[model samples]
Target: MTRDEFMGRLRRGLVGLPTRTAAEIAADYGQHFDDGAADGRTEAEVAEALGDPDRLARELRAEAGARRWDQEQNPAAAAGAIFGLIGLGAIDILILLPIVFPVFGAVIAMLMTGVGVFIAGGFALVVGPFFGGPGGVLAAILFGIGLMGLGLFMIGLMALLTKWLIDATVWYARLHYRVLKPALEPSNNRSQD
Candidate 1:
């Protein structure tokens, strides 16, 4: 491609960047074309030597992202960034699932047990009164019902808390890729060099 075509494509790919920043990048590439031409190379040769416009845009974005990553001091973001990089492929899944699930599974099991107890307590409250055959079992049944209600309330609270935690975990995982993107791009630069 000619210099104009290459610069146009680069500008398009970098639309998300600030106008001045994108213009600067385009100008730098334009200079590369000029320098190459002065050395008796065609525009296509300079563009090809520089690499694909799309990849360059991604790298630039990633670099910006990484810089932001440095500025933000979030522990969860750090963990997500690590996992995000690792979890791109199958090995991360293999490593993460085993590490993650055991704790989650155990917590779920204990929560379910609490719910089961509340249900059983409710059933007892319903049945114990009838089986007593019209004695002062009314008081006992009322007490049992109170206990069951309390249990039900606890379960609801637990459910809400668990949902919030799960939501946080999911959010962290999703942020992983964007955080890692900048870090990953620089490695490509090193390799290409």
Candidate 2:
């Protein structure tokens, strides 16, 4: 593809983006073509190196959404990021959805279990001395303490796991882009033919 064709396709694909944002992206890509020319590469070579304009636009949108979510940490931004990532391909629906849903369920269950245990511990601590003799009272206190500690540990572990899951999703998306980029390049298709 020529530089004009590549730019036109990219601009069309970026229709929903803010005008200034789209213009900046276009300028950046235009600079890429200029740099390629300086290195004695043709417009077609530069366009091929950039890969499909539509795919590139999708990636840029996803990346921008992710960045917005990271910065704002709001539900709308997060939803946008998620939808953007989902638009990248079928792997998310076919593979990630199955695994992520179960993992999310497990995390929620852990949280519930932690809260239940903590409440049970509080109940034991409060009612222990009323139930029996001194020995029983001491035993109750110890057991209550243990239960509360266990509950706190579970809650903390769940938090860590949640963070890890988020980090892994972001990492996997970036890895997917890197791994698929070469395959998407037009030069790769010509070489295969």
Candidate 3:
């Protein structure tokens, strides 16, 4: 597609953005086109350099949604951003989704097992007298208490693991923004040589 087509797609994708923010993005890309032309590049070459418009649109929309969510405290906007990106389509799906889901499943399974163990331990402690004499009952109760403690610890660890997963995903999103930020800038405006 040409620069005009790119801009049109970008504008539509950025509809959720504030008018000024959307216009600024369009202007930056338009400037990118003009600067390329001045440097003797063809429109097609510049558009090609800009990358696929449809995918670009999705990226821009997701980025805009993330920014809005951050600035305005909008949960719906945050959810929209996540859905729009869907692992950013940056990571290899075959590598990412399969690994991520199973890890997630394992964490959840661990959490469930922890809860189950804790419950069973409580039951055993309550029925300690059914085992044998007082010594046996005391031994059974102590074992149950140990199991309950271990289970609670495991559950807490799983909770931390779940939080870490989300934190890691957001880190990827931030990294994507960092990479794209420079690509969108005019060559002359870039910080690197």
Q: Whose lDDT is greatest here?
A: 2
Error of 3 at 20 (Å): 18
Rank by lDDT (best first): 2, 3, 1
lDDT for predicted candidate 1 compared with the true structure: 0.65
Better model by lDDT: candidate 2 vs candidate 3? 2
**Candidate 1: lDDT of 32?**
97
What is the C-alpha lDDT profile of model 1 across 1-193, one tens digit per residue? 7788778878887776568877888888889998999999998888877776766765565444334344553544444333433435344457667865885676667678768768877887877777765546886587668778777776776666655554455445447656755664536467778
lDDT of 2: 0.81
State the TM-score for model 2: 0.61
Error of 1 at 28 (Å): 27
Q: What are the clash counts of all predictions, listed in order?
A: 0, 0, 0
lDDT of 2 by residue, 96-141 (tens): 8888889979997998898889888888878876888567888888
Mind sharing the TM-score for model 3?
0.53
What TM-score does each of the candidates earn?
A: 0.44, 0.61, 0.53
Q: What TM-score, to 2 decimals, does candidate 1 have?
A: 0.44
List the pairs of residues colliding in candidate 3.
none
Instruction: Estimate every model's Cα lDDT from 0 to 1.
Output: 0.65, 0.81, 0.75
Q: Which consecutive 10 residues in model 2 have the weakest lDDT in total?
A: 73-82
